[model samples]
Target: MLKNSMSVEFMAISDNERFARSVAAAFVIGLDPTMEEISEIKTAVSEAVTNAIIHGYNDTGRGRIVMEGTIYEDSVEFRISDEGVGISDIRRAREPLYTGKPEDERSGMGFTIMETFMDSVEVESEKNKGTSIIMTKTVKQVGK
Candidate 1:
């Protein structure tokens, strides 16, 4: 039987994108989530990882993104963290169109996409401590 919560850690590399999403999907599978729900979770995970690589690390080809998943009776929580140049202003980063790298074709929609895909999203960071994004989604049973 799966425990009330399951946690998995992974290094954040561009090549490991699929692996990260797979880990999150596995965690939610235990909750018996629907296909659509699974897709949403995976998308959210992808966005988080992308932000870690592109924004958190500034795409300088340094640092690693750490991802974790926690299962609960009614919800599954996932956190993506990275130790790199942290965001100076999270509020500005979350704006509708606030790309740190606009010239690179970045739409600045990472946080927005994450928030839209997941039920809830929380972000924490310090100047040199790194950044962490926590997201949660409640599972919906098919029948009573």
Candidate 2:
């Protein structure tokens, strides 16, 4: 069962990445997460949003990114998606330090960071369709 949820759509621009991160942080704040948890969630969200804007849309700033956040009893799920060129290799993309755009100096740590921060990270994509990154983090409920 879902305790709460929110969905927002914004242009795939660099500036909106911060907005996405803020939204995710706000959504999970009620869970009474620690500073480290909040930072982790923000970083994960930033990485996902950055991938959508840079790799997914090729930084054209023309596509749209849909960010969805869902809260459960003990966890929060965030989905960041884009309607642009999709990832061709899910496995390769998830590999640490494996960047699809080496020319851009990208560290290729987006998925890695997301996976490290969240309890689970799932990626769904299709050629010329788009990519969706779904990540979940369970609140530790510290001191509760």
In model 2, what lDDT does residue 105 have? 90
Would you estimate the TM-scores of all the predictions? Answer: 0.90, 0.97
Q: lDDT per residue, candidate 1, 1-144, as tens digits?
A: 234665555555676678888888887787888899999999999888888888777877678778877877768889889997888999999997799899999988888888888989999999888999999988895532
After superposition, candidate 2 runs with Cα above 4 Å error:
none
User: By TM-score, who's the top model here?
Assistant: 2
How many clashes does the backbone of model 2 have? 0
Backbone clashes (count) for model 1: 0
Ten residues in a row with the worst lDDT in model 1? 1-10
TM-score of 2: 0.97
What does each candidate score in C-alpha RMSD? 2.2, 0.8
- Model 2 scores worst on lDDT over the 10 consecutive residues at 135-144
User: What are the runs in model 1 whose C-alpha is more than 4 Å off?
Assistant: 1-9
